[model samples]
Target: MLIAPWFTITVLAGIMIAALLAIQRSGQSRYDSLVTELEQTRVALAQTKATCEERSEKKELEITVINASLNREIAERMQTEAHAKKLRKQFELILNSAGEGILGLDTDGNFIFVNTAAALMVGYEPTELIGRSHHELIHHSKPDGSPLHTGECLIQQAYRDGVVHSSSTDVFWTKDGASFPVEYVSTPITENGDIRGAVVVFRDLSAFEP
Candidate 1:
């Protein structure tokens, strides 16, 4: 039998060892790829959670802003109502203290409100005149003694014209059957340039009545 050379045996052993090292390196490369993929998935999940949280916070802030706006509107409405009530009380005090007769009527000529002195002048209790019509209360007449509708009444005329005037031809009859000639001034009350009502102040002219 021929003997194998030592040099050939050494070369063959070196080739086998190199092949084994290449196989080990391939296994380690596969493990490294799996680790990189897991890390990327974790980063994606964290970004998604952060985005959801940001959206939720924005919605909460919007709700807070809306609630604040509604609160301000409610406060403004309450203040307006309070101011109107105060003005009405002050007006009533002045009306009751005045020596002259005063009256207020709505747009439809219905008595919406009145004062104590006005009731005393007409010979009725203040509560009794709250809903009464002017035609029911006033005995409107001409110099020639004619029944009158308020359409032709002088106080109404001044209200329509938005003019203030004083007159002596006016007369008001008390509930006690006493008729009085009167000198009076009538003025229109307007809001936003629209006629709301009129105020009439008067005194009896019985001393000079013929």
Candidate 2:
């Protein structure tokens, strides 16, 4: 019951050819799958790149807007400062032109400003009086060498009570410790319904007194 040698050879050759065909088909299938996967990956990468570019553009735009806003704020602040400086200079000139001695005080009785006439009358430079206590400089004592009480001083009361105080008998001292009679008016400076400080207008009575 042994098969013929030629038939056996033919059958074995056919099996070998079938196996080779199956392997080739499987390899081709795998190659097609890999190609599809690679195409998908490329598409995903392109989408990611587009999204990143869009976000980058938005960030750049935001930065540009912020810089523009900051620049505008700086410019406005500088302009306001310049205008304020100009106004201050004009105010100073007006005060310096007055004939009467003019003195400005802060809430704490410190000298904020003194015009040229005021400084000369007090025998001091304007720079010497600024920021100094007004009460301590020329009005600390009476002509009789007694210490003047803060509660009774008309000058102090002007700012404390937010009222106008005047006196013709009060005496003011010079830098060299000489005293002279003065007719003076002390007026409170009110702004926004609040008393901020005081302004003193005074004239030396030494020239007018007999």
Candidate 3:
């Protein structure tokens, strides 16, 4: 059977149009899928950025806390040192203002400190008496010019017994080798039932004698 030429041409054009429509639909579907994937990737990146920001904030907070603690500790230590220095200055003022001779000793009978009166009584400066042996400097002899042993000294006895010893008959020698009568009280310094040293307070009795 012979078909019409115009009819065949119209049928071929219709098939070509359908094929082009199908390709356009397939490209549209592929573009939609790509858009969805891009949206998911963007959401994942935002979450990761938020997590990194949170961790950075936490680290900054930790550093701030540590710095604050260190600053507080340093301030407290400086305050303590200032308080201790003030106390030491007050102690020195009191000792220098005292009338009676004051001598401080360590456990081994070494002179740790001496007040102004003590240095004047011995005819020496306060610095000269520091670190000197107490027994050798002023307590070396008895009133009768006899040798006084360390064991027989009343001050030594006070250290051993951890008690106060007072004697009006004791004698202390001066730097010029002159002897004078002294009334001294030796009291042991103790801490927690342990004797550390002695404090000797003395006055010259020559002025008081009638």
Candidate 4:
């Protein structure tokens, strides 16, 4: 009934070798799976980096285009303003050099512009006449020292009727309260067929009078 010693030793050695082989196979399989997962993670990171880089480049391009457009608009606006300023200076020079007394009035009969000849004839500085009421300053009374009503003023009527009023018998008062006859033409200023105000061109009749 007893087993041989050599057989028992050979069987025990075979079992140990089988167990060690099984463990090595399992460890190799797990190592392969870990390597695969690491590769996938690296690929995902590279894709994310590429997407971010593309978005940054697109945003930078948009910003550059916007800045260029803004710069162009600013340059155009400055050029337009410079041209307007030049035109305004030329207009002022022309008005000042005119021989006739010329003045501009607003819708309410206030003086908006008074040229050199107009200011001198009215005995006022150009600045002093501007913003002052035209009727109150120069056309407030008749030649006989009677108050002239605003409703009866021909200059006011010209703009109200959108017509030209010419008169040689009108009287305009000076700063010293002296009345002088004036030959004047009141023309309405119209824009888009709408009357805005009036411009008065006048000549002093003092030298011609007796």
What's the count of clashing pairs in each model shown?
0, 0, 0, 0
lDDT of each: 0.57, 0.69, 0.68, 0.69
- Candidate 4 per-residue lDDT, tens place, 1-210, comes to 112432332233223322333344454555555555555555555556567877656555655565565556556556655655565466557666765677777688888767788888889898888788999999999889899999889999877998877778789998988888887777776655766677777778886767
* Model 2 clashes, total count: 0
TM-score of each: 0.57, 0.65, 0.61, 0.62
Model 4, runs deviating above 4 Å: 1-81
Order of all candidates by TM-score, from best down to worst?
2, 4, 3, 1
RMSD of each: 42.7, 42.2, 43.5, 43.1
Best by TM-score: 2
User: How far does residue 12 in candidate 4 sit from its true spot (Å)?
Assistant: 99
Model 2 residue 87 distance off true place after TM-score fit, in angstroms? 1.6
Q: What is the C-alpha local distance difference test score of candidate 2? A: 0.69
State the lDDT at 205 in candidate 2.
80
- Global Cα lDDT for candidate 1: 0.57
